[model samples]
Target chain A: MASSPTTLRLAVCLFDQVTALDYQGPIEILGFLDPNNVKPDVPTPSYLLEITYLARTLEPIKATAGPRALADRTYDEVGDGEQFDLILVPGGQGARPEKVPSSLLEFLKRQAPGAKHVLSVCTGSWILARAGLLQGKKATTNKSVFKAVVENIHGYGIDWIPKARFVVNDDKKIWTSSGVTAGMDMANAFLEYLVGKEAALRIRGIVELSAKEEGDDEFAEYYHLL
Target chain B: MASSPTTLRLAVCLFDQVTALDYQGPIEILGFLDPNNVKPDVPTPSYLLEITYLARTLEPIKATAGPRALADRTYDEVGDGEQFDLILVPGGQGARPEKVPSSLLEFLKRQAPGAKHVLSVCTGSWILARAGLLQGKKATTNKSVFKAVVENIHGYGIDWIPKARFVVNDDKKIWTSSGVTAGMDMANAFLEYLVGKEAALRIRGIVELSAKEEGDDEFAEYYHLL
Candidate 1:
């Protein structure tokens, strides 16, 4: 049997103080689809999940931990209307600054227009909010920062959907999740959507993600109490 | 108000497959001594918690997540007869290998002689066992690998304490915990030992880890049945 075509471009936006796990969780899961690991029955025998750290420049981005991660490409490098299959924004202290860099906001706005899917982990949604991409959209973030996201960003109508641990809004084009660790959960959900439930489950088993969508209700209950 | 003489030298060991959260959970709490946020009265100013990765060489260690984390120093560089206040080993697939590298095992054995306290997260106890440090000692690892740690290693007399969620044989200078995520709990337990319960609670509050330790019983009840 002939192997299926591999074509999925995933660009993860990175900046100072980007939560390392947020970007790592998704990248690890997707990168595991190496050609060597492809099963015969899989439609996409070897899915090319190309991950790039979309930044303003190729400078080293400092993570929450002291280590600095180098970016693969700049915003302009992938410019000229090149469409990506998925665009991910990670959240951390970096997202809470008083002023969102205009270049970053413009880059995000432009990326959101043509990407097949736009996702945010924790306060990464704040970036989308500043870019005017989350207007009237249901979203979530680090529970502590939820109020900040809602009260601070103007003209970005955000319906704080506290019930869903992670919310997929506006027809799956926009996805947002809660806290630093939930990035893995969000990635698993997206994998389930892109591939199938079984593939997602297989990946989850490999990664040992203890919490699932079902447990989201428990998280919601805790969130309410908090 | 001279700061109390620094007593503890906390070294978070890094190697292939080291879980980031395992090291981060304790380091975040111990490294930052922000008393204003948690407890005002506690006089436990942050000690000199030196975070370093103990690797065979100066080469960057590959974490399970694929990113290369550079170590500050190699095991050999620490010099002969150097004593550590505490040594932390994190769990991951790297620790589960049939044969622990001779260099690593030698380093662990040598270091164990002078360490004031030793802690292991998830399967990190296996590395301790390979060094003959767990002989005649009670310890635990991630529930999945506990049995292997007991039965697989030869001439290592471990009690294989099964009931406790996390085991600390203070007499034996050994601390072990379950699974990848339990590093946080183990770290908290260590802090409680060194700085007292009040200090531990304060750090836990800052990290938002106030929840009760998720014991092995809960893990078995949920996942083992499935």
Candidate 2:
């Protein structure tokens, strides 16, 4: 008899002025967890992820670009104490440390301890840093604002990797990626970690995405952040 | 004084069971048109896009994955006679030729005649083909479903390119891309076509997306479509 697939609940944080790609990209890559969606009809992976989009209100959340997105639930509905298997924070105009909401920080602070994994893309790491969850951890953020993020979030003691497309702190169950589209690369790596290389490779092939390694980041050098 | 930015209206098609990434990825690349969101803040491009998401109705449109997306208008709101500068169609379960709404086909048949550009990603081309927009035009679709799509859509007389990431019909102002993530690559190229190489290169740098040439498709060979 086959073993039961592990069900992972995911919380995707949404906010006004969020960059559409920062979160949407990862969702696209990770969405292949549903076996029916995978091309060539691959067997079900050992893990299945149930995604929930959360926001402060049920109102439509306007992104920095593209169409607005609707959240599945509000932060108040989930409460700070609710634990999820995975928590995703995506960066955009709203994620600027100064612009981030106290509610998001408080929610992260309350949930990170109990979450199995916490992931972020672009300046989403700034929210994680501001929440103090990345203290003494290795992480990366959007390369364009790399210096500003590192300077602004003083004393987090976070090792902000300058030359990484994505950083994974296995000990802390945290993954951080750089910029808008890098989230897809990080999600690809995360998929490999959750399932295996073969499954990840299959999805990558289906999507026709060329995978970039953690150290393959050229933006760090482009922005003189290295 | 610099010339006033040209406002190009965009119509994004949405439906139930649409693939989030299929549409979201291109929007991320193209959304850089809003000068305020660009990193390092370059001068505004000559053309600015006003995006409007169009669906059959105003209710939140659920994608095949991730959060639900809200449309800016309904098909009735835009009417079949409305014209747009650009029209984007993304593919997923709902985009199957048989599943697509006649309202969408009518909208495309009406709009494609006057739109500056009409773009489709993944199985989105199938919708175009069914709408008779891609008749005798060069195009491509998701490689996993390439054979089925080509075989299924009969008498379109479309030049289906098996060894390409995206296909552009300059004469017809039609652009189609392969699979899901390939939309980003096509959008990058489309950006160049709209704003010039330098501007597109800068946006690519900010987003950390490496450009892929239209002929750089590996999935074609992977699926033996080449």
Candidate 3:
């Protein structure tokens, strides 16, 4: 018998001061791509895309975006046997190394084993690093905060890949992007992976977003000339 | 005689689908405050503040928070002669209203009279509202769209208010708050002019938010009962 198509379960982590765009950009894209919203003219196959705000507890988490956002369930709500197709960690001021709660770190550690893909935006990589997930993975962050991430964290064996606008370090099942807006770029890439580039491109056209390459080739070419 | 510390001229106008809470609520309080964020540690001085977002223009505007916002400024700019202490507008999805160009609205209006106050949060309220003197309006944004403000538009509005639970609608002589946050509750009754006791108290504590009181007790009891 043919195996049933796997449903994509995406959990976006949230906390106080979390940058609004970090989640909003990707969320909006995902929400738009949702089969429910697809116009009759568009051909979208049925895909169970479940996006949830994974918080530490059931309490409503405040977002940098004006109103508070409530999570569908707490980190503890998901059982050990449960698996997620993707785990998206959005960055913000709240993702500071010192401020990330232990509960969140523990949740990250527990979920990593089952997550088919672990993605992060901007400083969100910091939290994954805290969870010991980025030890050997290549990652990136906001350009301004790049230096601090390199100097502040020690002995992780992680490849500090600066210069690249965004990096896909598939070896660790981790994908990272620079700054907050780039989260949409990364999400688009992931969407291409799930629904094929054509569908992702269609969504991009609908949203009026420009296509962005994953790595920084212009800088690399400039440095080579020198 | 000194003219009472020069009235902090503040304005927050209405627009269609404009997140009513975003503009009205914040402007209400900022107009009532002393401009220093100085409260008596108690909510008592909820009596003095003057702010307005009058539709000086006939331009149809859009808000990022929801739908369209109407502009009060009839002229291209808030005339060079009339300097305002502070000027603001809110954001909604209306920023992209049909046949309306809010950016043009923002571009034409000059800052009130002098180096008056200028502010906005969430979307391009700062860019589209046309608050003059934004060249140096120490400001923070909704975090998600800060880049659009900082990069797409030039000049300062950049003293990022990190601690502000909302935007501070601050201009040389004015202040703004982030759109749709608790700032609305604070704006409605606590800003410059006092809003009666019961209404003010109802919005302040976040409690009794749903409790509806139709007119005053005497009016309801005596008139309705009869």
Candidate 4:
């Protein structure tokens, strides 16, 4: 929001059985916001992101598919008034109602209210819906299991879109995406919103990503969600 | 190669300043090979991958941008005769000659010969090239910094291809990909090779990845590498 270099604190939520790609895809795209990784001649970057990986504890959190990721801090460790500019919740088997930790939902309920923006990858929206954040909101989730997941989570007061790669809330405070790799596409658009199109394009160019738009989802049709 | 279920051990090399996406994109795609994630009625999974993250030390390996990854074992801790079915080398700022650890190169040199498949994402090929493993082999690296990186690494004798998304040598033992996100495409193709086209397609469909072929690179033209 400033001409001078500004830093945005990002809180990445991690839990056991979390899909590594859900967080990794977005983190990889957003990592380009680091000024050190950006070109020196770019004058001032719109924002330099400072990322913090949060988990229930400081121990290594095992992903659904294998590979363990270490968290920087525990959700309980954050002070009462502490807030971040961005919050990321990734989905996996851990996102199920029975498996999802109440502590995480509580953390999100606290942090999301104060955060500038909240993002959920795949069924992470399920957790958000479970936490009552998605009530009266428009969102989408992983399509392969769309019917099964969305049908059971009744009375959330959410408008679930079936044929979209990602959907943003009317207020623009919340962003949600389809299955795994869609996080990268959502993140590309999210970066464009945060920085500018030019900056986002440069980042995507370096990573060689052909950013797909919100309406460009083919999986929606393939899965017969449309 | 067995008809019955078989687990392939994967060694993921990590270092300070390594780009997270370089490995994450591929690992995410490859993780689906796990039988647990696969449908029970699918009969038999071609291969189930067991991933092991390796680093110079047991401490968290900080990436070039932000966030840190924990390693399962130190390279030295791996037994002398131990072998991995698949070895992954990911690149970032740390992949440079001065920044890379000697121990990593030594471990790669020792491990690669015994590996069934050696994969390098982004400038991870630089590491492979530096390890003297790319000699008399065809390969590709991240295109943005391609010229500068390959030019300086003299006498590796690698037939560096400038206009490809990824390259596989005559023997198909080594696979090198262009830039960060291109690793996913490489992994997609690699999955098809390891498993079957049907299985890879199912995995990609669930992840919603519109797989890109080897020559579907626009970066080559964008960077004037062609």
Instruction: Please name the candidate that would achieve the greatest DockQ relative to the true structure.
Output: 2
C-alpha lDDT of residue B136 in model 1: 84
Docking class of 4: medium
Worst 10 residues of 3 chain A by lDDT: A217-226
The 10-residue segment of model 3 chain B with minimum total lDDT is: B207-216
**What ranking emerges by TM-score with the best candidate at the front?**
2, 4, 1, 3
Question: What is the TM-score of model 2 when looking only at chain B?
Answer: 0.95
Candidate 1 docking quality: incorrect, acceptable, medium or high:
incorrect
**Count of backbone collisions in candidate 3:** 61
- Candidate 4 on A5-77: residue-level lDDT in tens? 6899999999999988898888877887765676653335678988888999877898876457788899888
Residue A140, model 1: Cα distance from true site in angstroms: 1.4
Between candidates 2 and 3, name the one with more favorable DockQ.
Answer: 2
Steric clash count of candidate 2 = 0
List RMSD in Å for every model shown: 4.7, 1.8, 18.0, 2.0
Top-down lDDT ranking: 2, 4, 1, 3
Residue-level lDDT of model 3, residues B1-226, one tens digit each, is 4233444555554444343335533432342254433334335453333543455355443332211234444434455566555555555444433523453365335454443444453443454433443444455434334445456455444554423324434222434443334334334323322435643542332111111121111111211222
Fnat per model, in the order shown: 0.05, 0.83, 0.00, 0.60
Write down the worst ten-residue block by lDDT for model 4 chain B. Answer: B35-44
TM-score for every candidate vs. truth? 0.77, 0.96, 0.52, 0.95
lDDT of 4 at B80: 78
